[model samples]
Every structure is written in structure tokens, then in C-alpha cells.
Target: MGDSRPVYQRIADDLRQQIDEGVLAVGSRIPSRSELKRTYAASDQTVDRAVRVLKAAGYAEGQFGRGVFVTDRSPVGSLLRTGEAVDSPFAARLLAGSSAAPPLLWEATSTATGAPPRIAERLGIGAGDRVMCTRYEYLADRRPLQLATSWEPLALTEGTEVVFPERGPYARRGVRERFAAIGLPVVKATELVGSRSATSTESQALGCSPGQCVTVIERTHHTADGQVVETSDIVLRADRWRLEYHIAFPG
Candidate 1:
């Protein structure tokens, strides 16, 4: 049967297969516009459409004054989720067991602000409630790899040493440890994972192409009494990282 698919689509599929088979290795330049036009007997518009499809699907990228090229799809690293994540900084948990690269860096800025509706809901507080919000950018193998924003209700830590997550004597301590010092021992946690196209802000911040796929994690930590302690939203490029989870089953 003839391919009912469009010419541009068939072209994209063939290129994708070549990429998968390593015939077109990462960093290898794809055929130029004129070359593809001649080879496929395709119009300039059809060839352009095929290239756009490759870029959008993350199969290729274009360089200034250069033709499109296959992109490296290997993950930069993985985020390890284990029992220790409750007490470890998010950046520290990334590839801690693997020799990813020396010197992981986490840049963070915390501000006292009112929670947005979505964040408020995750933290189980009213919209616009006061919370200490911290934004983080993590570099793995010295590449901007992940971004996260955390919201902690001020009601639970007002005037306390841990009020500012990135400041004070308890700064940088994980929620379970820091909250335990103040009488809230976190006992439960949950995460909802999903994926969608990266937003413009995310694309610029992470240095990836626009419309790339990203994994979104909505995570919450709860105290023994069932009160939520902290919640966070995390984003990472789908082509550059994998999420690994570890669960301990009590014998």
C-alpha cells in the first residue's frame, strides 16, 4: 500500500530512522536544503516543513550559517529518588551514585512571597498565603539540567531558624531534618509526574530549543500529623535526564 502520510511526514520518518540507526550520528550535518530538494524531488516548502518537523521533535537542530544536524539524545544524568531524598538536597540526589562529573552546582534564590493558586493548592494553603519561595537551577556535568521552585508555608516556620530555606543556621538542610528540629517530622511524601512541551521561559533557562519535551514533577512532603511541610514543582529536559525511583519494602 502507498504511504497515505504526507511527503513531509515520510521524509521526517526516514530521517528519524537514520538517526535511530546511527547512520546520521549526533553532530552530523543533515543534507542541505538544495540537497534534500534534489534527492526527494520535493519542493522547497516541503523540504522546509520536513526540517521543521525534525527540529520540533528533537531529532535535529540548526546552527547559525550552518545546516541542520542530528541532536544528541543521550541523557545528561538521572535523578535518584530514594529514602534519602527526604533528607538530601535535590541537587545532591542527582547522579550521586554515578560518576557524572566533578562539582555539581546549585544556584538558589529564596524570597518571601504570596503563593500562587497552583502552588498554594500543592502546599495545602489558601491562595496568596505567605510562603518562603525558593527557586533553584542545578548544573550537572556543568550543564544547566534542572529547575525547581519550592514553597514552604510561613505559618509553620515563622520567626524560626529555618524560615528561609537557603538562609540561617538550618539553611540547605532537607525538609525532614530541618522540620524535625522544629517538631514536624515529615513521614509521607507524594509525587505526580507528567510531561509536556517546554515553555519559552523554561527553554531559555535550560538552554534547550523551544517546544522541547520536559518532565514535570509535583512533589509534596507531609508531617507525621498529616500537615504538609513543603511542596515543589520540578522541571527537566526529557532528552537530557531520566528519573529513577527506589522504594524500600519493609520486611
Candidate 2:
């Protein structure tokens, strides 16, 4: 029976099948666009759309001059059981992989600005409250993998050495550690995970095509007395990353 799906979908499906079956090995270049068009007996636009689908899914990456190729099926970003541990830095905890690759590099920009209403609400502060907002991009081998925006109420850091997260003594430290430095220890964290279409800014920063779907992780950290200490919004390319959680059974 003929496939009921659109031609582009059929082409994408065939390529995806090959990738899943290992017929197209990781790092191996996929057939050129012209070649794929001829083989699929589809028009250039159809073939191009099929390839874009694969690219958006993170199954493939296009090289500027070289042809598109399969991407390694590796976890680009991870969440671990240690995420709630105060002594451990958040960035280090997430990037602690057994892979032989070098450590993930992060570029962050921080500014002392007023929190937006929604973020202020999450942080349990009044709307328009002063907050230190830091944006982060984590890259592996210079390839963008994760983006995050971390917020801390200025009340928690004012007059403290760790006030400016990227410039102060506690620069690059986790929320738990920074708060701990100021005698506010983070004892718990909650995260909400969901999916959404990437905004134009997100698409540009992540190198994903317009309207690509992404994974969203919203996290809130609490102090020992149940006060909200910090909150963050993290975004990752769904096609390029996977989130795994290790749930321990109670004794």
C-alpha cells in the first residue's frame, strides 16, 4: 500500500528509519540534497523540507560547506539526583559526565535588573522587585547545547560579596552555594518540565530552525526555612538533548 503521509514526511521517515537502524552511522554524511531528491523521486523543496525536519529533530547537523551528517546520539544536557545537593555546583553537577570529552564551557552574562512579574511571583517577591538576572549558554566543544536564565532577589545578595554572580567572589557558583555563602542554605529544589515552540531569540541562540520545539525546565530553590532563594528558566534543544531522572526507591 502507498504511504498516506505527505511526500516530505515519507522522505523524513525513511531517513529516520535508516538512522535508527544504524544504516547511517553517527558522524557519517547523509546523501546530498540532489542525490536524496533523485532517490526519493521528490522535488527539491520536498527533499529540503525532509532534511530540515531531521535537522530540527537533532538527528542531523548541516555543515556549512560539507553535507549534512548524523549527530552522535549522546545526552547533551542532563539532570541528576545530585541536583538538590547544596555542596555541589549546579553547572558542575550537570556537566559531570563519564565521557572523555573535555568539560562543557559556559558563557554567562549577568545584570542587576528588576524581575518581571511572573518571575517575581515565582521568587515570592513583589513585582518589579530588584533582582540579579544571569543568562547562561553552555557549550560543548563550542556547540551550543543549553540556555538558562537564573534570577535571585537582590534582597538576598545586597551588600554581599556574591552580589554579582559572574563578577564577585562566588562567581559561577550554584544558587545553593551562593546563598550558603550568605548564610542562607538551600535545602530543596523543585523543577517543572515541559515543551514549547522555540521563540525567535531562542532559535537564533540555539542554532535551531524557526519554530523548532524545545524542552523547558523551570526550577525553584528553597531555603531551610522554606523561603524561596532562587529561580531559573532553562531551555534546551529537544533534538539535541535528553533529560534523565534517577528515582530512588524508599527503603
For TM-score, the strongest prediction is: 1
Off by over 4 Å in 1: 91-100
lDDT of model 1 at position 62: 87
- CA lDDT of 94 in candidate 1? 42
Q: Where is the poorest 10-residue window by lDDT in model 1?
A: 91-100
What is the C-alpha lDDT profile of model 1 across 1-251, one tens digit per residue?
98899999988898999999999999999999998898889999999999988887788988999879898887666677767663466533444454346577788999999989988888889999999998998775667778998899999999899888878888888888789889898898888989998898998888677788898988899987789999988898887788888777889
What local lDDT does model 2 show for residue 251? 100
Alpha carbon deviation, residue 239, candidate 1 (Å) = 1.6
| Cα RMSD to the true fold for all candidates | 2.4, 3.3
lDDT of 2 by residue, 142-251 (tens): 76777899898999888899888777778877777788888998888988989998888998888776577898989899987889988988888776566766576889
